[model samples]
Target: MNSIRANPQAGLDIHMLDVQFIRDNLEAVKANCKNRNVTADVDRVVALDEQRRQILQQQQVHQHRQNEISKLIPKEKDKDKKQALIQEGRDLREKVAALENQVKEVEAELKTVLMTIPNMSHPDAPVGLTPADNKVISKVGEPKKFDFKPKDHVALAEALDIVDFEAGSSVAGQKFYFLKNEAVLLELALVQYAFGKLLEKGYTPIITPDVAKVDVLEGIGFMPRGPETQIYSLANTDLCLIATAEITLGGMHRDRIFDELDLPIKYVGMSHCFRTEAGAPGRDTRGLYRVHQFTKVEMFVFCTPDQSDGLHQELLAIEESIFQGLGLPYHVIDTCTGDLGGPAYRKFDIETWMPARGEAGEYGEVTSTSNCTDFQSRRLGIRFKSTKQKGTRFVHTLNGTAVAVSRALVAILENYQQADGSVVIPEALKRWVGRDVISRKGGISG
Candidate 1:
């Protein structure tokens, strides 16, 4: 029932938005909900908060009367008078207990209603209903014009004996595949390449747990249990398999209060991500483009409010650098309000050109960076104390995909495919992959 309180020590009563803020900005909050395509009753939250306050006042009054009766009972000399005072005290105690219970019930209801409300969107974010409405920021590097028919990742992977879909399906059900031969090497190289880039940016590298507690997931704005949830929960346990390293990284500092000097704490996390791909039936179902599980390198940052905007752009720039290093052609997108996740105030995505996507070629999202702007930190109870400020304040949180190995491979393979059925590895990853190209005859050779 304590859905929002992940940090017991923090004593944080506020979730995404406190009742007072909702009351003051009632119209704005309601409009944000509409813009984000979220349905929430803003008025109900205010009503529940008022009801809870009233019950608490009544409970305090009865508690005070009970205390007074107890004192009188101890001093009274007459036996009947003493007994009557004790009885009165007992009656008052019952009334106080009943009111206390009502307060708790109302508080639970209030939190439940608040959970339905999402974080406010950034003012600069475009207001739209779908991906079509998202604004294009910039396009980088031109898509390659192939002299011959280029194969999609599936055909390229299968023809070169780099991935075994049948075995993967037989072993782990559908939407799973085995990386064979050089594909295994490619995944490792991609991770190493991303890690190297992040390390250069002074990011601490961490290998995070693939599974996290349900509350931790919720604290990071993920629904771990529901019909629409893309998360996979372990039966008979409160843990769920993580969909991204962002969940574990964000939960890492739960209930923590850092010094202002440590305002920007950056981490590059590596983890195996799992998703059910719920409601995504047939769209991009083929190959590694849309899969149930994959390896990922994720970037997470926690910083003061003033530092978050710059850090968000920095994350996006890192993502762009990684893709650009791989020689992949891509474009940047400013995500619209409706396309943004519940915790993201603003988001930007890098869509890499995949050679065999449509009839000719198309852009597909490979990485994204989001500025949550204290939305997640509030839920996770992560705060920072400044030398100038009196008390601690919730730190802003941001996450970006450094590299999703599966999708990165899809882009690399399709884009670098040659007429002779060979796929060239990017120069940046050549050292780690230990080869210049992957072909049937050479397996992996220069």
Candidate 2:
């Protein structure tokens, strides 16, 4: 890894630790951002931090004066002197209170500013502003050549009676849909298949909680219960519904330290994830491609820094294998620096070929995996010790999607449709779904 100074001009959110680290290795942070296309706002964040420290100094001076006056008032030699000391203490208390309020305000503003800064990108990340700029690293299984005009997932869903978009809209508004008949079964089959594979690969099975505390949510790098987020919050609770199993899984070990021997822990979790889809108002609102809520099997691992890179690739392989088993035409892309989220140092996404998307059938993202390194571990206080090391070090964390049931159903249903309006369930999932095919007669309507 190369080290470079972080550019103060680059738009990045830096904390106390980030500043200290950058100050010690400014060149490394800057070079990393340049390589990853990560924009860091070092100048602004650092200046505000400096302001915060200056405010603290003023506050400390006032507090010290108050403390000295407090001690003096009790032992004044004369009445006038004692009265003056008491008055001075009251005035000092007022000034200190006002300064404290200002400090709180500055701190809050600083937090908001810092939150906008993106994480440093990996050296290998492609540089671009949008998904269009994402570099395709690999393509697998040539896209199926179709002779007839292909129906989009929505049209095919209606024709096959496998999805209920209208009813879903009527009941839960747009972006909320119901998977009927084969679609439902396919969802179950996908989750089971993915979960079983994860188990075979030495991952512990867990069904995590769907709701998490606000602090836990923030600690895991998600905005806690906000309109700008894609997460839903309970009306009267401090908990917010998770956008993915990663939230709950990551929160599981919050404020805890792990034993040195347990340097690596892997978990496969199944959970009903909820998202408000706040920013994406109209995109992918037609069907299961984008929904307010969905079930997913998520893979999360905590390991020592030395093992993270290998584990990251392993997680990516598992995602690719699941897509391969489904027999869907897809491509893998290395996410760019500008597009990667706050927690991801590097990310890879699997986009399946969706016949309904574009003129020649565009790809739709099915799964993504991120190597967060120690960013999350530091915030969560999850550290592990090694026998050879003097003290514990923050562990690296990674998360990848094993199966997102709703979207997988979309991929399978659209890709497997027959000319006769029936669906052929993938052979790998037959035993789990208990049906080989879904034909029109079996899809009889009410």
Find the candidate with the highest lDDT and give its number: 1
Error of 1 at 277 (Å): 0.8
lDDT of 2 at 324: 94
Task: Judging by TM-score against the true structure, name the best candidate.
Answer: 1
Cα TM-score of candidate 1? 0.93
Clashes of 1: 0
The whole-model lDDT of each prediction reads: 0.90, 0.79
